[model samples]
Target: MTHIRPTAAPATRLALAGAVALLAAACTSTDSGGAKGTSTEAKGAVPAVSAPPSIATAADKALPIDPYLLSYEQRDQLERADSVLVTRCMARFGIQYQAPPQIPGGNRPRSRTDRRYLEMTADSAQAYGYHGAEGDRPTPAPPPPQVSDATRLVLTGSAAANAKSGQGGQDYNGAKVPKGGCLGEAKEKLGANPSNNGGGDAQLARDIDAGARERSKTDDRVLGVFKSWSDCMRTKGYDYPDPVKVLDDPRWSSPAPTDVERGTAVADVACKQQANVVGVWFAVEAAYESQLIEQNTTALAQIRKENEDRLRAAAQALSS
Candidate 1:
């Protein structure tokens, strides 16, 4: 994964959009739990809706592997730390860099898995349909400020370089662009191994996050719940064989949610609760992650430590 370097700013907050974008983007954009580009605070206000019908809501909470990875807030800290370092580095070359502002909590998902299985609760479904959860959607990002070629070179080592790359060292303005450019240098300083892009363990944590979810889809236990949930959907008059099929339906494939789409989405959540699809599926994947953790305790322990240490450094960097 060659990343786009962040001279512009660190990770902008992301939110999920409504049916129009999600009808097209959900399948692809949801892999990593809904990362996005603009601020988490959307331009408009969210209308209130009735609380979702109560059931086993544990799946809406954290999973076993969650403790090993960075929280949304910690991720925010990493972004702040990266931006701070890059801003400091750019100052040396007389380029003005504005670090991204700190993101307040509750504006972002508490966990990346908050919508992983997409068993969106009824409250959210009633409000946004299949678009996304309460605060889901990638807010549209503004155009990045334009910079000259020389500034670009210093900001990012290559034309498409990201802060995670450690190569592309060069000299400019009587000073060397630290082993990587300012962005990459920032990455290296913040504990990510720019050479490998994730310090090795971080990527593994990501693998665990995505891999376990993908693996759970095929697990027999999940398949069983899918059947139960599917049966429940049929009773509601929807003929979907499974929840996945509902998401893949051509009917909901529109920019705007139809009365039909919202109705179907509501029924989807109702069926999910009636069948406890999210609870069963979440438990199954959590068990899978537990096995993975047992198998990779050494690496996971290291990842946990690195995350804590990195956050500490990030906090110090920001406070200073």
Candidate 2:
């Protein structure tokens, strides 16, 4: 349950090339139903999607306890540990490395169960249209404190080193940069390397996410709701086949939403509400995730244990 402190600039952001692109396409709206000051709870009989006892029970089960999904807290702790190691190593080279300041009040954290489309509430739709309120959110801490040229040389290793066949590619003070550079050394010390599939945890996390997205696209229940939503949009003169398609519309690319985009977004939310898209989609995905979790219990347990050990080491590094 250790919270991983986020870095001023997360290197993981760079590592997750494709996954980050996928996330961008799946961007959630700021106005989750609760945040919009509106209620989505049904006052009477639940829709077929919410009425099934098995689905209801599954939905109630705590989500994202699976092996692959690292809780925000765990991710933050791991990042903090990495930063601590990096700072310590830099200091040995006489480089003053200041860790980035934490956000005053952290931005709302996304849960593993939370879906991008589901976050669009009627209230949010009415207010911001399809343009997400990302600009309104608190900015992340500034990039890590500036380093002098000597420090940068040590941290990045030398391009000149690659060229030099001998002398071990000397860095400042003729020191050989450790294999993989300073960042690699920090990761080695922490026993955290997402790029290496032999570790399995990072690769598994990516697999689970990719699997869910794929399943969602083909899930009968989800597709059914999407059809209803699409039909509703047709009545309103919009031609999007699904929510994802609607998000991809070029009109939404502007810094601020255009009237057309806003109007379409509002209608989109209305259709989603009318069709109970979020409720149905969530239940179906929950079932899928539960099955995946059951199939990978042992692998997940090992990942969880490794995470714990990493955090403990990170704590020690920070304290020291």
Candidate 3:
């Protein structure tokens, strides 16, 4: 999934952080398409639940697209701007700050989406089975140079002081730490508010996500592919209702997948390939998103304008 760092806005920074984490989770395959599981039938038929198309349609109309839900290039520019700001902030205190090295490839979605719902590639399934690469991914870059207590007090204001004082610290060096400290200042300098278009964007994301999952539950195209996958799993002695059930199986909850889990995962991928589950689901989701985007052209255009403005501000901030 795309990783947009949260802004340090006083009212919504924490909420945005939580939302980003949730968005990450949403784009991953960890939650069985982000739907709760139901008991499987002995015959492997999934129960159907009808969804309203209006859910997707309404969500798109109600909220503006977030300017910060940026593409990889935009995110890179923002990160650079952030690094520059951090370096300047630290320099003010006579501290040299070396920005953390960027991850070699940087973070970009491998596909149109994060492939969370449909992540099992033929090779991935054969090699690692159902286990995700979360454990195997590269460690994060080391942090920048550590700051001294005095400098921390200057940057963070009272929060750091209160942590040391056993009292609420709201000010630093006799001044309140801006909402998120120096980091917040950096974000503000770039003209980015981490809040979701004043919270509307966040709600829109939730609505769209929920709508997509609901569609997955009942979409005829998805169900047809799922039936084929279920039949294939049954041949392998697994009686799963759908791909979601395959991951949601309690037996796969161990630190490492049980042998059965691994085997089942391999079989699951084979069946998904045979049934073309990923292709069908991807097309369906793209269609839904296209409709949403089409319905919100004005709002999305406004968001684009805002993003352009912020990028311009970031450029000025860096040059200055």
Candidate 4:
């Protein structure tokens, strides 16, 4: 699957990885056409459950696409397993390497949609304002272990990492560097390396899922909600085109939330409630995702299977 980073605003950036693909070796299997689901939803026809009731926020509601997606935990596990594989490959070249930390030292794991959408709760808006975090930030992870010029080439499999790194040629310590270096070899083992024409048809499902999100932004239903939200905000002296505009407001950039930021956030949540912005927006996206899922059930099934395969392999790699 293709792993596109979330396009959410910084404040909305949390634990969700959306449709992150798995790392695997059998992803290169041929496409078997598309899969089918029981959903026979006709064109322009949204499924039942148009929208959640008032007070039912995204935090408690999983979208139609959630079942077909990789949770943040699954993505993290696959990545750590990939790192372990890479570390082993590095050992073959006589280089000591440490895998980078995947999860934070102390924090609850975030869900796929914990903060996928904008914060719509009155409490959160009032507490942290546009800054989703509270208290001092966690210490940043340490820098990656430094390697020698020759080691860099073996690690990255990139001749362009530096001039001296490449001059050592493919043969280092009498062992040839894998086609793409250790990283490349690790991906090759998982069959998830796209550059080499690897990967399964599950990418089709991922593309559709990501496409729904991008297209939803311009959807007329969502656009209508944006206007209502904007008008409601104006009544409170917060003149902004839409909620997204506030994400870029230069006034919110600081070490902490200022009084002005808190006030704006409080008003923002109020406007959202007044306009039912979250309710409408969530339903629209759900409809789009539902249609896509119904249209591509076969491919989605393959993705789910491939992910399970990756987890098993990753678990084995971690144990070894």
Superior by TM-score: candidate 1 or candidate 3: 1
Misplaced by over 4 Å in model 3 are: 1-68, 98-109, 112-114, 132-135, 138-146, 157-180, 197-210, 253-259, 315-320
Clashing residue pairs in candidate 2 are: 3-77, 4-73, 4-76, 4-77, 5-76, 5-77
Which numbered prediction scores highest in TM-score against the true structure?
A: 1
Q: Which stretches of candidate 4 lie over 4 Å from their true place?
A: 1-51, 103-109, 134-141, 158-160, 163-176, 195-202, 254-256
Candidate 1: where is the Cα deviation over 4 Å? Answer: 1-60, 99-108, 132-137, 157-174, 194-196, 199-201
lDDT winner among the candidates? 4
Q: Candidate 3 lDDT (Cα, whole model)?
A: 0.50
Residue 156 in model 1: lDDT: 77
Please state the error at residue 224 of candidate 1 in Å: 1.6
Q: Which wins on TM-score, candidate 1 or candidate 2?
A: 1
Per-residue C-alpha lDDT of model 2 across residues 30-65, encoded as one tens digit per residue: 211122221111123222334522221122334453
Candidate 1's displacement at residue 301, Å, is 1.5
Residue 203 of model 1 has an lDDT of 56
Candidate 4 clashing pairs, residues 3+ apart or interchain = 24-190, 24-191, 25-190, 25-191, 27-199, 27-200, 35-298
Order of quality (lDDT): 4, 1, 2, 3
lDDT of each: 0.60, 0.54, 0.50, 0.61
lDDT of 2 at 271: 85
Candidate order by TM-score, highest to lowest? Answer: 1, 4, 2, 3
Rate residue 180 of model 2 by lDDT. 48
**Model 3 over residues 171-284: C-alpha lDDT tens digits?**
544544455555556666766544333212323343444444444445687789889989988998989888766654666546554667668767877787777776665555
